[model samples]
Structure formats: C-alpha cells, structure tokens
Target: MNALRCLGLGLLALALPVHAEQLPRWEVGMGVGGVSMPDYRGSDETRNYLLPFPYVAYRLEWLKADRNGVRATLFDSDKAELNLSLGATPPVRSKNNVAREGMPDIKPMIEFGPSLDFNLWRNEADNTRLDLRLPLRAAIEARSNPRSAGWVFSPKLNIDFVGLGMPAGSKEGWNLGLVAGPMFADRRQNAYFYTVDEEYARADRPAYQARSGYAGMQFLTSLSRKFGKTWVGAYARYDNLHGAVFENSPLVKRSSYITYGFGVTWSFLQSSELVDVGDN
Candidate 1:
C-alpha cells in the first residue's frame, strides 16, 4: 500500500507549478519526502511514510505533462480546455485495519477520464489565477485481471498565486495553490469502500449495503518553490466526510482528517532547448 501511495505522490510531485518564464521542455529528477495520512479516506488508522519519488515533466502543444497532472488535450483555448486526466487511490489491507479486520482487502485503483477546466479569473498585476474544474473518471483496480471499481466526479475551484509574498529581487520562484471541492460517486464506488458482507459482519459490525450520492468535501493547499536545480514543496489536504452517503457505514471510522507531505527534488537532467511557458 505504501508503494502505491508513493506512486501516486510521484505523479503529483511532478506537477509543481512554476512562474511564467522560458523553461526546459522536459525535466527529470528524483525526490525524497515524508507523509502522514490515513489508511483510507474514512479510516482512523494513520500512517507515516518516508519515501522516494521520481519526477518527470514534459511540455507540448497538444499534450502537456506538467502541473495539471498528465493530460491529453482534446480541446484547447485561452479561457477553457478539455482534456483527459489521471488519478490514483492507495489500497487498504484488511489485516492492518481494525474496522476491516477479517474483511477482504481493497486493491489499489487508478482513475482516468475527461476534465473541463475554465479560467474564471486572472490578475496579471498580482500574478493570481482562478479556475473552475470538473472531472469525471472511471476507476479500475490495479492487479492481474483488473476490475472496474466505479466512477467518481469531482468539481473544484482552484486558485494559484505566483511569486506572492516574496522579497524584492528574490530569485526563488514560489507558487501557492488552493483547491476546494465536493465529490460524488456511484453506488459501486461507495460500496467498494463502505460495504460489509454478511459473512464478514461481526457483533459490532453489521452487514450494510452502500448507496452513493455525496462522497465528501475537500480543501487543499500546496506551496512549492524552485531554487536553481533544486525544488522544494509541501501540501496539506483536509477531507470532511460529515453528511456523506457512507457516513453510516461501519467502515467509516472518522469524519475528518488531514493529509500532508513535503519533498525536495534535484533536477539531474533537463532539455537544453527552452519553451515559451510565460503565457502557459
């Protein structure tokens, strides 16, 4: 499960935002970080991690592998873009969790689908940008004979600040991002995490079927900076499952929690050729 978490974090760390400037079209690096998070969204179990992640970035006209996650552009404009996005979820072992003891383990899952991003506002003088993002993805378990988990929809408002609160003549390029959103999922997706089978039910845990509507709400903040060949960054996310459809499920041990991590990366390779990312 930690390996799966590392993979997801690696993908995320590669998308660090940069100030508008000419930059290499590609970069490769490695990063080490520590993280503290729950076993799953609603699980009470907390785990700390010290892991290494590879960093990769690529910029292209129709395909961009940058701060927005890996994407294949289907439609593009100055104010809006429609693209395919990818995401992942770490697995949970039943044996390691008290609520899931004696129950089946959950597999790591990958998600991919289309996303529509709209630039709602921008302040060129302050270098601030705001966007509304809507993404719907299909989830699939990772393993031999992978199975479909279900679909998830998340709509969020994202804001970014570049070079904010920096000292005069500071060379460091700092980016701060804030995102908040509500999540929704189908019955099958909710069931994957919340369902309890009759055979696995105990005196304290009753068999229950999960039906989905609202999953939860989340707020996240990320800060990153680039210093010469090295980059450092951290992020924290707050998840609230209060009033969620699965709140009543026996597996939901906590209603709110925070996940956070920080990392440092040294870019070992980058393209000699520069691309005009000033307006990107």
Candidate 2:
C-alpha cells in the first residue's frame, strides 16, 4: 500500500534540474528501492519497504513526463508555468495499527489539480535555479467505494543545482534539490485520518474532531545523477506537525519524523527522437 506513495515521492525527489539539452523524447526502465517511513503522517508505527518501480519519461510539446510525473501543460512562459499535478497517500489497516485499533481501515487516496510554478531565479552560468510552486488539489479515495477526502493546498520553494557542485561527469551532471513548504488541508481530509468517533473512542483515546487549516511543514532534499545509461538518486524528507489542527488527535504519535530512500535505474530502451528540453 505504501509502496505506491513511496514510489511517487521518490520520483519527485529525483527530479532533474532545469537546463537546455537534447534528450530522448521517451525513455523507459525499471528499478527498486528501499524506504522507511511512518505508517501514517503522525503514527509511531513504521514500515520498511523494498519495492519495484517503473521509470518512464515522455516529453511532448504539450505533455511532459519524467521523474517529476506527467503533466499537461496548460500555460508556459519564460518565468511561469501552469500544469496539472498529482499527489497520493497510502491506506492504513486499522486492525494492525495501535492507535487505530478497533476503527475501520483508512482507504488509499489520490489527489489531482492544477499547479502554478514561478521561476524566481535562474543562473545559467552557475547551473542553479530557484522556483516557487503552488498546487491546489482535490482528494478522493482510491478504492471501489471511493469518497471525497476534501482538498489540500501546498506551496513550496524549490532550489536546484546542476553540474556546478557535483561529482558526476560533464556529460552526465548531478543535480541537488531542496524543497520546503507548509501544507494546508480541509476539515474532511483531516477528519479522515484524525477523527475518533464516540463509538470507537477508547479510554486512552477520547472522541476528537479534526479542523481545517494548518496541516504541517516539510523540508526535503535530494541528490541524483545519471551514469551512462543508469541513474541513481536518494532523498530525505523531514515532516513536522507540531502546530497541525489534528496534532491533538490520539493517533498522532509523533510531531516530527524523517523519511528516506535511495534507488537506481538502468534505461534499456529510449526513443530515437530527441527533443530540446530542460535537464532530465
């Protein structure tokens, strides 16, 4: 369950920097990685995952796809870009979780919406760039009995470095990325994971209601580089929920935690067609 979410985050973490270069219009491959993270946002229980993931990249004029995920470019300019974005979270088995012990299982969720990204700064000489990304998405359960889970709005500042300070070869430059942001979610989304109904509340866990507002803050850093036909990457993310609206929920066992993982992929096939695009 967590594998899909972990794979999505891993791909985003390994996103390539922005630069003008010629690359295959499409590339396909596969890889596996190990991840360690909390069962849920604030849960004390953790799960370690070793999962296989597909690697695909398709760069079309209006549709772009890469490690950062697929995007339908609605608008593009020298300093700003508007596109479709996505997000996901793993489900939780209540019976297996200490905090959620007699409650119903939490379903997996998927979010999709538009994102507006601004290029704050770019130094071609130094191969560095800074960007601000604002994404607003609506969530829905992924299972057959799907239901709305409210919405989320997350805005982050991202910085990327390419070639300037990396150990990779000149042809295959390394990229370093850093992102930090605070998240906000609606009441329904919060309640889906934090609310403890009276019927299911226990002595140690009283009935609680979750509110809409500050979800938390996160800081993530990643490093990656392609070696010939193989690409390798790693990332670490820090999440803090000290001031979240659901911080008081009994299910929230930790206010802060770290998620980390690494993986490598070897591209066995790529299109002969090439496109002039930013770094990949």
Candidate 3:
C-alpha cells in the first residue's frame, strides 16, 4: 500500500509540468546550507551539519477572482499543491564515543522522500497571505556505526502568516510562519534501533519496537524574504516525541531537539506564456 501510494504520487508529479503560464503556475528551486539541533540527550548541543535540499511545485489554478479587494486563486481545488523534494544531511559523529552508550557508533543522518503540499490561503494584494501547507514525507534514516536503515512516514503542517502589510522601508520583505505535525513509522523501521531482539536487539538494551501510534510532534517558526530574483529564509524547529519510539531510538533518542538553520533559493526558469486551457 505504501509503495503504491508513493508510485502514484511520483506519477502525479511527473505528469504535471513545472511551469504553467496561464492561470496555473509552477516553481522550482534549490538551496544548501548548515542546520543544527540542540537539546537532544539532555545535552546543550548535539546534531549539527551542512545540508542541501531542493524542491519543485506545480499549481493548477482552478479558480481566480477578486473579492473584498483581495485576489484569490485555488490550485488543486484549494486543498493541495503538487510538490516534490529531495534532501540530504551529512552524518554527525559523536565527540566522546565512550560516553555515548547505546548510541549508534556510525554517523547520524536523514534522507527525504515524495511529499504533497496543501495551501489554505493566499493574499493577492501583495502575493502574500496566510497559508496552511502540509507535507506527506517518507524518510530513510540511519544511526550508529552498524548502519541500520529505517523508514518513516512523516506528515507535517506549516502555517504561514506572511507580513505583506509591513512598511516598505522596514523589513517589509520578511514573512513569518510556523510549522507543526506528527510522524508515523513502521515497526520494522522502529525496531531497527529501538527494539532489542535476540539477534537484532542490542546486548544491554531490553526488547522494544518503534510503535505505529503518534510518534512525535514538531513546532517550527520561520522568516522568509526575497532579494531580487532570489529568496532567503531562516527557521527554528522544536521536536518532541512521546514514549520509547523516539526516546529509545539510537539515532534520535532523548525525546527533544531544536533545529535552527538558514537557506537561499534560486529559481531556474520562468515563462510568460500561459497554459492553453482546452474547452470542456
């Protein structure tokens, strides 16, 4: 079922073009920078490294109009947007290898998968408005030296309140946004690190499995701005997990982490011609 869903999403993204000049729209960008998370494992600092992420979006404008002096447009019926992204973060090695018991001796890392975005609102006046975006992300994660692999299906929501009304002279280009969501992982993925089976489980740790229930919740706030044709943003995120799913995991154990980072985006293409809408 999961593989089928991923294939379906991949097809959808492939069927849609990255750009539509008419009522529809599309955008693609790439970014690279450093990111860090503190507060994991009762420590002041832990995971920190450079990462690169790139994404593309395809929006089909089904409705366009002006109401109450605000212009509105709906893509995928105001419920969703076609989004695809790929990212990789360099592995983090422990400083005090001996002190890190139960911790994977290998590097800690993350990988991204297919995702979808649902937009709630957009302000036409300044092309900025409140938006609720959700991402259905699949993950391939690894921790410790043994190099165990885990798969996670994480769905996250981001609420964006763009400050379009700010004074032009001030930091008017800045937009503030927040993100919150939960993640679910399959038992196999969870068991890779959390569970202690006779063969797979660690020697000192008791038997455990990453459960299918609500694994964790995350909160993030971000500020974004545009400079000429380039876009720049910075964000801070807090992660908290319940029970042993996260607390017992070798990679992300400790239950909580704070991630802060900045990134720059560059557009590769732009078109003026609109998509030809056929008569139905």
Candidate 4:
C-alpha cells in the first residue's frame, strides 16, 4: 500500500548533519507495524496497511544504507558534502478515491537522485547544527505498468539537535530535527497525478491539464531515541497546497493536510564494532 511511501519519507527524515559519534556497524532485523495514510497527496480518503519490513543498515567510512535508503559519500568534508539520495511515493487508486472517480490509477513511484549540503552553522557545545539542503529526484513508476514519470526538487533549511539540545542528554534522551521547504515538480510528473482527459471528464469534473510549477510547501519534524535494545521514532509532516499549480485540478480535494506516523523496533542482530566518529 502507501506504506512504502511512508517508509521512504521516514528514511529521508533520518538524514541529519553527520555527527561525530561512534555508531553500530550494522543492525540487521525486521520491524512489524502498520501505516495509515491518505490515498494520495491531497486526498481525504485514507488507507491503513499492516506489514513487516526489513530494518537493515551497514555503517561504513564512506557509505551507509538502511531502511531510509542508501548514501554513497562522493565528497566529504567539514563544510560541505555531496551524496546520492533515494526515496519513494505510494500509489493512487482512482477506484477507491472519490475525486478520481473515473481516472486512471497511479502506481507507486521510486525516486532516486542526489543531494548537496552545506553546513551553515553549528553549536559544538550541544552538537546542534543548521544546514542548507538541496535534493533532486527522478520518479519512476513502480507498479501496474511501470515507466518513468517525472522529477521532483526540494530545497530546504534544516536544524538538527543531538540529545534534545540538553547538556545532560548525552547520558540518555531524545534527538530532534526540523526541516522546511517548498516542493517543485516538472510537467510530466505533475500531470501524472493531476491531469484529466476530456473522455474521462464528467459533469462534476471537467477536463484539465496539469502544469509544471510550484507543488507545495512542507514542514516536517522528527523526534527519536534509543532505549536499551529498542529504538523508537516519530514524525509529523504538514503540507500546504494553497497556491499549487495543480490546485484547480478536479482530482484535488484539499488545500492542506497533515500526516503523522511512528515506528518502534528491537534489534536482535547488531554489530559490535563502533563506527569511526567523523563529520561527512
């Protein structure tokens, strides 16, 4: 279901200012949980799914991979770095959506690309830093007639804190992150989800073509912590499509919405080696 997309975005949220701390070399296990989310970006109808997912990660000197995606460090330094980025979006089924009554069903999308980040500032005392991030992705349809769909770009500012920005947090506590940015899409990508052809138009829904332009703005937050053998994380995302180029499309039903989810996992397989602490 849409859980794959949720899982993708959840992994993206894991990206932070690479901290100078030893991390487990690997954590191999699985997580059992469920995801509840809207059928599409702005749809009011929601779907819930229950499934098990692998939670595998290998931390290396210049590479990292986990449930979120993979990162191959191409350039690494104290001030800046460039790396590959990957994520995904869930499918949209017209049959189950009111607004998309007679339209074609959209499949899950696989997004992969690159990201460049610059460290804007840092508070060494609290291990907190602010960074400017730019990521561009090419979306590929991943179900029911797969093909290349479109591209997405997001440039945002991020603030990350270790141990909840508290001096005592070093002992035990929470970590937090915040990112705010605007979303943009190319014509082909925008049209894939919002376009309506004349033949499929009805009295209540007229034919319309989607254009390439601003898609929306999003504000997202993540709070997570590790306790004993268990790790827990939570996230919330808010999207406002007030002035989106496709807002007038017949398939669009709302101008704004919020999505939230949480996941917990217990590691049964783990690496004994501690990662080399450095900024990358």
RMSD of each: 2.8, 2.5, 9.4, 2.5
Ten residues in a row with the worst lDDT in model 1? 1-10
lDDT of 4 by residue, 20-104 (tens): 6666899887665555667776677877766567677797778877544566677657777676767777767678888898778
TM-score against truth, every candidate: 0.90, 0.92, 0.58, 0.91
lDDT-better candidate, 2 vs 4: 2
Best by lDDT: 2
> How many residue pairs clash in all the candidates, one count each?
0, 0, 10, 1
The parts of candidate 1 lying over 4 Å away from their true place are 1-19, 167-171, 278-280
The candidate with the higher lDDT, 2 or 3, is: 2
**Winner by TM-score between candidate 4 and candidate 3:** 4
Residue 202 deviation, candidate 2, in Å?
0.9
- The count of backbone overlaps in candidate 4 is 1
lDDT tens digits, residues 1-280, model 2? 1222545444444654577777799999887777788888898998777778787888998788776666665665777778677767777788989999999998878888898888898864637778899989898899888888898888999998787454433435678889899989999988988999999988999999999999999888888888877878888888999999999999899989888888777778999999877632
Q: What lDDT would each prediction earn against the true structure?
A: 0.76, 0.79, 0.44, 0.74
Give the Å shift of residue 93 in candidate 4.
Answer: 2.2
Clashing residue pairs found in predicted model 1:
none
**Best-to-worst ranking by lDDT:** 2, 1, 4, 3
Segments in model 4 whose C-alpha atoms lie over 4 Å from true places: 1-4, 8-12, 15-18, 165-171
TM-score quality measure for candidate 4: 0.91
User: Model 3: residues >4 Å from true position, as ranges?
Assistant: 1-32, 38-45, 51-76, 92-113, 121-134, 140-150, 163-172, 196-207, 244-253, 265-280
Using alpha carbons, what is the TM-score of model 1? Answer: 0.90
